[model samples]
Target chain A: MTTAAVTGIGVVAPNGLGVADYWSAVLRGQPAIGPIPDSTYPVRFAGQVVGFEPDRHLPGRLVPQTDRMTQFAIAAADWAVQDAKLDLSGFDPLDVGVVTAGTSGGFSFGQRELANLCHRGPEHVSAYMSFAWFYAVNSGQISIRHDLRGPTGVLVADQAGGLDALAQARRKVRQGTRLVLTGGLDCPLCPYSLTAQLAGGRLSDRDDPATAYLPFDVRAGGHVPGEGGAILVLEDRAQAGARGAAVYGEIAGYGATTDPHPDSGRPPNLRRAIELALADAGLHPADVAVVFADAAAVPELDQAEARALAEVFGPHGVPVTAPKTAIGRIYAGGGPLDVVAALLALRERVIPPTVNVARRTVDRAVDLVEAPRPLTGSAALVLARGVGGFNSALVVSTRDIVDR
Target chain B: MDAFTLAELIRIMRECAGEDDQVDLDGDVAEVDFAELGYDSLALLETAGRLAREWGVSLPEEELTQVRTPAGYVALVNRELAQSGAGG
Candidate 1:
């Protein structure tokens, strides 16, 4: 089976704009969640990427009209491309592809444009409003900006879309594409955007900053919204090895399922998703040393996830944690962010802290990492579930990690 | 204006348009078309919505669209409020 190795990673999150800053903030357990100060829209809290001006990273000519989401993906993709040290002088454009996942594309732009259209008339709207909010704008922009001509696609599996994108990118590699840039980007923090999220009923509305979000705890109330994006430079491991490229971790497994409605009981879909990802990697449950559980922070949601883990890992005692709790959830970007955390954890032999969580676990039998702890491991599995029944898991192995 | 109390309702008009748009009451500011000052359609809508939120009144869509300038908007809002008998 063909393997996909993440050679480069780039990120833009509320906690930090770049991957290094993001990682450091997560390690230090920085809490970036707070009340939304913008008076235009009403939402209690959001994870906003402050001080991010899309123009600086974007070509001047294209700056005025691109959606914020596309700007994020392009910026992150550019970083990943640079980090991979790809000599684009002779890189085959047709052999490269772009795949991205987004929760809501160009939402802020859409809200603003709609506000304008409602007030000023049809002629007052910008020409770019039409394409900016479309979900596939990230993939389209990245492919256009980078000159990637192979396969291009977008997934809307909510948060799991990140891992689903990796799976699709891997499948593309097996089908013949040599290089693929894949990841997820989302910033659903705008007032109009946040109000839509408020309609979901699962959103955490804790006015108190301290007790606002608590995932996978006995007092788990609900999850908070955060904005950010993560993109990985994925290439054929064999091709990378031939060129002596820096390899981070191999995409060994991916599982995905849907639970549609929480009232239906924890459906069997997520367990099947986990099993498929394991089967794809030709590995059993025992092969995983650490489990990056999706700490959604909603009491019922977290409980359902716990039930899924119990069914899959039963008595194995694999360590589980949700590092995202430190920086709030980044919607579609959550799964890939967890993937990056998993890769780093496997590399450093240490699991990142799940901040703001009480040391007590809902299920004490499971080895949950509340605080940062060191673990000797060769492989790790990251699990994530999205609202409206999207679930995905990925297994990344450190069989090829090397210092660059 | 005291810091403790809310700023005047007309203050929103200046704040939304940037520093150069602030004007004295009864000045030509009310008559100036928003587009003439580069206040695009979206900006006008956002401004009106902000005004509605601040004044605690629902500005009907018809009245909102009829007011294309800052003064027109403020007058329309005052008229709608007076008709509802909420304020003078």
Candidate 2:
């Protein structure tokens, strides 16, 4: 079976800007959630990517042409390509593709342009605004930068979009694409986007960062909105081996499903998605070493996720962790970041903690790791749930598992 | 009031989009194509937007599209300035 192997990973999270930095911080259980600087919004706390200077990472010309989200994406993609040690000249440009996910596309840039339009009329608006605020602009800009001409696309399943984007990249790899740059990054901390998020009523309004986003805990209120995410390089396993690329893990299986209508009196299908993903990978639930949880940090939503995991892995059957508790929920970026964390856990033989949840306040049948725990399993399960009923699950396992 | 000079236009162009290392803005670049100087239509539009806000000279989109060089952009902006009684 042809599988998509993760050859490189790039992260621009609030906790860390690169894979090494992020992995260290996650292992240390350092929390990055803090006050949203220079803001007066009710939900003032979030995971902002402080100290990210685009001028240092990107060319000056691209600064004005992109939004913060796209800037992060570009930087992450460039780093991923570098990490993969990929030479674009060797492969036909048509065989390389880009697939990414975005939720609140370029809100800061759009807000600035809208302010200009309101104060100075239509002529004051920037010509770049036409593409800068687009959700698919990340993929377009990355493709244009790398000259990737094959099977590029953008997924918009909110948080689940990150995993869905990787799934799309896997499909592209299976379809004969030599390489794909995939994952997601998001920056929705601006007033315009925050207002939209506030309307959703899922963001925690607490001023305290430590207790603001405790998933599955009795004190669980809601999640804090955050900025930044990760990008990954996915190459065909054989192609990666031929190129002597260092493999992180294989994107072994994927399954996605939408929940039934709220009025249908039916249960959420998160369990089915997990089961399907395991089946796709030809593994039983017991084969999964650990689970990277969605960890919505909302009581009912957390309950639903817990219920799903219990149904599949049984009560306290499998270890689960929500490392995102350290960085808050980053919408589309959160899932890919989780995938990166899972891959690192499998590679390093340690599971990073779900920081700040000292006690399991809720009666969820899953064991939440609060500290760095030694990993003994070869495969990991990553699950993501988007707003409006999008559920996605992906299985990533070591190369030996793939060989088997 | 001051006339928008090619030097000023070049400075603004550089500010809007970084100058290409291959092209020296300090040289005789008044008649050089903006594209050759690494400035695109969007950069020029941004430069024009800045001029409108700072100098109260709004270059129409049609006229702006006709500008292809620093000298042309300076001339168009000065013309708009003269019409608006903001020219030197």
DockQ of each: 0.03, 0.45
TM-score of chain A of each: 0.95, 0.98
lDDT string, candidate 1, B1-88, tens digits = 1111113444654454332223243344656776665455545555555555555456777767666766666666667667665542
Q: TM-score of model 1 relative to the true fold?
A: 0.79
Model 1 gets an lDDT of: 0.75
Best by DockQ: 2
Native contacts recovered by candidate 2, as a share?
A: 0.37
Error at A402, model 2, angstroms: 11
TM-score of 2: 0.94
Per-residue lDDT tens digits for candidate 2, residues A1-404, read 68789999999999999999999999999999988878788787898897789888876778878999999999999999999888887879899999999896999999999998999798778878989999999999999888889899899998999999999999999988989999999999989999999899998887788989988999898999889999999988888888888899999989999999989999999999999999988899999999999999888888999999988989998989998999988988998999999998998889999989976756658788988889988899999999999999999989473321
Q: Give the best candidate by lDDT.
A: 2
- The digit string of per-residue lDDT tens for model 1 on A116-225 reads 88997664565567677888888988887778898999998777888889888888988888899999988887777778877876677777555667776777777778
lDDT of each: 0.75, 0.89
Candidate 2 regions with alpha-carbon error over 4 angstroms: A401-404, B18-32, B55-68, B75-86
